[model samples]
Target chain A: MDDAPAYSPTPRTRATRNRDRVRYDAATVHAILDEGRLCHLGFVADGAPVVLPTLYARVGGVLYLHGSTGAAAMRAARDGGLEVCATVTLTDGLVLARSGMHHSVNYRSVVVRGTARRVSDEAEQRSALDAIVDAVVPGRSADCRPADAKELAQTAVLRLELREVSAKVRTGGVNEEPEDLDLPHWAGVVPVTETIGAPEPDAAMAPGTPLPGYLRTFTGASD
Target chain B: MDDAPAYSPTPRTRATRNRDRVRYDAATVHAILDEGRLCHLGFVADGAPVVLPTLYARVGGVLYLHGSTGAAAMRAARDGGLEVCATVTLTDGLVLARSGMHHSVNYRSVVVRGTARRVSDEAEQRSALDAIVDAVVPGRSADCRPADAKELAQTAVLRLELREVSAKVRTGGVNEEPEDLDLPHWAGVVPVTETIGAPEPDAAMAPGTPLPGYLRTFTGASD
Candidate 1:
């Protein structure tokens, strides 16, 4: 297999502190993005900062976000390309250090800085939308009804190239001061895990629609 | 019981797309913020947007963030009050609509717009540090060793009052198209739950150190 280009972080995406935690490999960045279900999208709106939690999907080297055509943020990005910073974070566990100052959380996060533009192509739009559905649950796009022409017309899709991206991760045990290590306080990690619960069927389901294989074994990206 | 002031939304915090999902009550916003363990902090640096995932705690009406005093972002915010947009999101489930266009995720999210200033008062700073610790695990600050003067001097705490904030929430079943209702496809929600697993003790833990009651019965913010 051909090697992918290294994700060189620009000034905007570079990790200013904890420089050692930064990861530049494309595979590592892609894996974290694929495992994430949501992205906190940040943009400058009306000369002030604004951050919104939204659904996103990564297809190859491009990230796609879908929303209504009339949505304010999407329209703002589509009319004139908007500079956007999107971040995805997965908290693994609470790092219980010996001292209050040393307490931290183990987490993996990725930040991407890019300009978002409208995806006007019909075929690409349909596939991008499918990629988002399948990102939520694998095999969901094929199992669900596809979007029709009218449905497609009402939705707006924005594409962001994964050029300026960086991933930062903190893992393993807690780091505490050596003097405080002997203190009479418990120091360990309490794992925070995401588990799939029993899927709830729609009340209007027609008869016995078997629970799809994917839903039965669904474990979200956090694990 | 004394009532809290309602969090009025400025143009920045308003939910422009889904106005119906916007919430103004302080209680609702505080609940969402307290239940969230992490937040995506958005700030502009050198005329570019940046978003970082970090731990935060909300005590009463003030939100505090603790980190190294020399960290670039915290220093920037401390030297001259920096405009910040902090967001916390809790994803409840994935809404699978019949059409790809309608696929959405059930989530509760809050956006706060304010200027972050250095927490100078020593007393308040100590309490803020404790709040940050207990925020991760209830009653953790009291259980852990308190920060020494040197530790306190190295740590920088920043406070942002919860003045301009708004919350947006989407719940319930999938919203499928009327025409697509007859399509033979599974449409439901796969609930996503954050659960606590068995706590792994530190390798260097002294034998016979009993796991605290709080750790034994730990339930993270998300149920």
Candidate 2:
């Protein structure tokens, strides 16, 4: 194990509530980011906040995001290092507390505040794209065709270093006040999970192309 | 049917890429928001974008979000009508394409841009809190203890009108180049889904309390 120190959270990534749930350890932050497939990217546009869902992957200490070169946000990030916030969240269950005020979701989330720069190196960009594909479904890149020169030129990949990050997590059962213990309502957690469904083949596929082992044994988050 | 006109997207909520995916209909936007269990709320802080995961609910055209009264973001929203952007995303599948550039995730998402105000009215606050509980698990509010006066006062609720909202949806098979169709690799979609697992009773629960109907039959988005 690398004995590196934990990330130092800036004011932006610090937890303002439930302070005990804040985790600055790299293991916790990376685990949550790896489990989540979608991230809401927050950036200021025209002096107002804008949030959009995007696909992302993490390699070592840097996270990569990709989009069409023509996209406005992608263009902004590509022009120069754009200050942005990327967040990934996984909700584990719904905590049904005795009182409405205490009801909450058991979740693990990571928030990162950094600047995203366009990746100009072709080899690194190609590998970043491959890592993103493997992030979604492991061992996927080997079975797929690589991007051609034209395709690579049309896509923009932005790299953000995970320098300022934190993971906030809540798990287990509900938190109820001692006075509300005798309330007549049933209270517990209803666990939420994300699972992989069966693979769907394309209509134009060769008749006997077998489903690869990776696709056949696919599982989410737990992997 | 009320037959009211659809929401008109401001420059903020409009989709910069894939304009065809943008939907201005209130029905589409509301359905996506109702089905989602959590939202990534984006708001500006000290000229920087901050995004956090939070639970929210919609009543008619208004969306309500709540947090601890001491939370910084909540306090900011309560102090004044703060410009906020809320986004909900449901990823459906991993679209494996013949080329790397064409790979994508099948998803449905909604982005709402509006100003959030603190809800101070007692009656409205109570119902909003109830709605939030129900949003996590439908019918939860009726089966759970209501919030007391003190709990209500300790919590802060912010309301955002859904006047500027847009839904972006992408479905179906991968979009691959015609020239790459005959590539020797497999290309198809691996469908993804979110579901609820069996309820685990709390350790201190009354011995004979049964799992409610809503918890037993919980289904996610597609359902």
lDDT scores of the candidates, listed in order: 0.81, 0.82
What are the per-model DockQ values? Answer: 0.71, 0.74
Candidate 2: docking tier: medium
| Model 1 chain B worst lDDT window (10 residues) | B214-223
Cα deviation of B69, candidate 1, in Å: 10
Q: On a 0 to 100 scale, what is the lDDT of residue A105 in model 1?
A: 84
lDDT for model 2, on a 0 to 1 scale? 0.82
| CAPRI classification of candidate 1 | medium
lDDT of 1 by residue, B1-223 (tens): 1158587677666555778888979888998999998888888766667777867899888889765423666777778887888899999988888777777888888888889888888899999989988889988999888888887887888899988988888899988768888877778887888887667678778987888877766742222
Best candidate according to DockQ: 2
Q: Candidate 1: which pairs clash?
A: none
Candidate 1 stretches with Cα past 4 Å from truth are A1-5, A68-72, A219-223, B67-72, B219-223
Q: What share of the true interface contacts does each candidate keep?
A: 0.83, 0.87
User: Candidate 1 at residue A87, lDDT?
Assistant: 90
lDDT of 2 at B127: 91
